[model samples]
Target: MAESLDTALVPAHVAVIMDGNGRWAQRRGLSRSEGHRAGTRTAKAIVTRARELGVRHLTLYTFSRENWSRPKDEVALIFDLLVEYMKGELANLLDQDIRLLVLGDFDGLPFVARQSLAHVMAKTAHCRAMTLNLALNYSGREEILRASRALAQKCAAGTLEPESLDEAAFAAELYTAGQPDPDLIIRTSGELRLSNYLLFQAAYAEFYFTDTLWPDFDAAELERALADYQRRQRRFGKTGEQVAE
Candidate 1:
């Protein structure tokens, strides 16, 4: 795998929308649960790879709020897998100095899942090498709405002024308040839409779509994404030529 992508343009954070696990399983005649389990293993490998590639933050869209619409059995399987993955990866996370954090609404999750998430987060809070943010039971639209409601409550209580709202103030209300916006967003299985993941944070993020399913993603794919990110000239609001000059 390629390494040392140009520091200037390489993404500081890479967020993934892991998709197509069900399709992958159906293709092979396996159960969706097995696909999810395989995807979890891929997640573990790529988190380590992201750290190796000098990515400071890696955010994974593990389970979206919308996922609850799926069959109840599938949803239960996902929650079970999350608990098991956290317990299994605890040692690896601590030994590798990777901080594990969860972003999203936990209010509706099963009690045991919530406890497991909290326990994992507490255990890895001190690791500084890299942060692996798992977006479990998360949705960007829901998050923004939650923040908006909080802001309104503050305004109603006279603690915040309605006229003082700005990007900075609004961002602080997000689930990822202290984290930098994702610089690159990866979606597997050739998906073309954001699927309501990180809508606010990925406003300017460069995207890399792959036909490979989430369960198949590995270190080489990550390196390719980083190398591709380095080759692009991100002008933000300006033309490429104007920004370069």
Candidate 2:
């Protein structure tokens, strides 16, 4: 029989690299937007499963900062989908007390998209349930660089001391300031690359890759990922013996 779902070893933070949407659509002879729409539905299911499995933080690789250069129509559809999704999920989010967080640089997005995101964030500020972080218009490298710039500016302005700059200090400037580093990062669609995702934050995260597309990733896949994470020993610089002890 299989082991009971890693209840004692569940990760507090889980991040996912949702990939293969475009390819999924192409294979199905559907519009890329349709794949994204299907992906959103999958997101809801994954969020529910994550909460059920005791995950406190769930981060999704939504839209990358680099995605702005994609086809104009595709980009527009993405924003439209985001707005519709927020409107559709608002009631359910409030009822379930799920906190919504949008990471990355938002300045490049359209005014309407920003407005929708801001509205949802403000309305969900009091939520106490699992935090759902959507990495919209985000890139990990850019995030860390921006944080570094902020630190430099603070020090130059005399608000922060030069000697106070350190790993913890820099980390505090990241968009995921109060959030824990991802303990497990799953990349779907068999992608081996990170594609500019959560570089600083996933320093020691265990990676799980699957051939399943974003829309195809369901509850069983998540359970499998968690199980894989639990079986591996995370030393974080310690020796195996030390970790075991």
Span of ten consecutive residues with least summed lDDT in model 2: 236-245
TM-score of each predicted structure versus truth:
0.94, 0.94
Q: Distance (Å) between predicted and true CA of 33, model 2?
A: 1.8
- Indicate which candidate wins on lDDT: 2
Kindly report which residue pairs in candidate 2 clash with one another: none
Clashing pairs in 1: none
lDDT of each: 0.87, 0.88
Q: Please give the RMSD of candidate 1 to the true structure.
A: 2.0
Cα deviation of 72 in candidate 2 (Å)? 0.6
In the range 1-245, model 1's lDDT, one tens digit per residue, is 46467655557789999998898899999999889989988998999888876788899999888888999999998999999988998999999899988889877788999999889889999999899999988989999998899899999999999999888888999988888899899999988999999999998888999999988888888888888877777788876452431
Q: What TM value does model 2 have?
A: 0.94
Give the poorly placed runs of model 2, Cα more than 4 Å off.
1-3, 241-245
